[model samples]
Target: MKTFARTMLAIVGGYVGTSAIIAALAGIAVAAGGMERSEAATLTSMLGFVIYLAVIIWSFADPALLRVALGLGAVSGLSYAVVLLLARAPV
Candidate 1:
């Protein structure tokens, strides 16, 4: 049961967390680097592959399932919040 849960979290949670992080990073790049939205998104999307792979590996490497869950949830939630704020900010 635990292994099943971990595998699911590694696949689903990692993807969700990675996506949120990529969005947040793109927002940051657009805001801070003054980059065009499309360029920022393209760069972040490419980087997201590596980030997602690392997330999946870490999810499995971490022995504590609860910690893995918490980390993923926290990061995903925080990144989503950043995305929301960025969307609301004036250009």
Candidate 2:
């Protein structure tokens, strides 16, 4: 059961967290780095794969399952909040 929970979190939660991180990064690149939207999206999308892989590896490497859950949840939630704020900012 613990293994199953970890696997699910590593796969599903990692994906979700990575997606939010990518979106937030892309938005930051566009707004702060002064990059074009398409360029930022492309760059961040590529990095997303690596980030997802790392997230999965970390999920498994971490000894504490509760810590993994909380960490991933915090990352996903905070990243999504950043994405929302960026979306609302004036162009």
Candidate 3:
């Protein structure tokens, strides 16, 4: 069903957006507060995933923006994954 697909897309978008925002914020907070690197990373990753899921569930009413949402979501997800991986290694 198209409606179902749209809903799923929207949810995914929301999740990705929320994940990126949460992760970035957490990273900033940890850096500013002088928290342990490992602790900060863990907290950030967890918070990102939780917030992402919550946002996706909450944004199920807007079907018109499904395609855009999906694209943005995928981009955000990929960006986060790449950035996180990069951060874990020496440049």
Candidate 3: list runs displaced more than 4 Å.
1-5, 61-91
Q: Model 3 over residues 13-66: C-alpha lDDT tens digits?
A: 566576676666655556557777788778777777676666555455544565
lDDT of 3: 0.65
Model 1 quality (TM-score)? 0.96
**Per-model CA lDDT versus the true structure:** 0.94, 0.94, 0.65
Clashes of 3: 0
Quick one: ranking by TM-score, best first?
A: 2, 1, 3
* Tens digits of per-residue lDDT for model 1, 34-77: 99999999999999999999989998999998998998899899
Clashing pairs in 1: none
Error of 1 at 10 (Å): 0.6
Model 3 residue 17 distance off true place after TM-score fit, in angstroms: 1.0
- Top-down lDDT ranking: 1, 2, 3
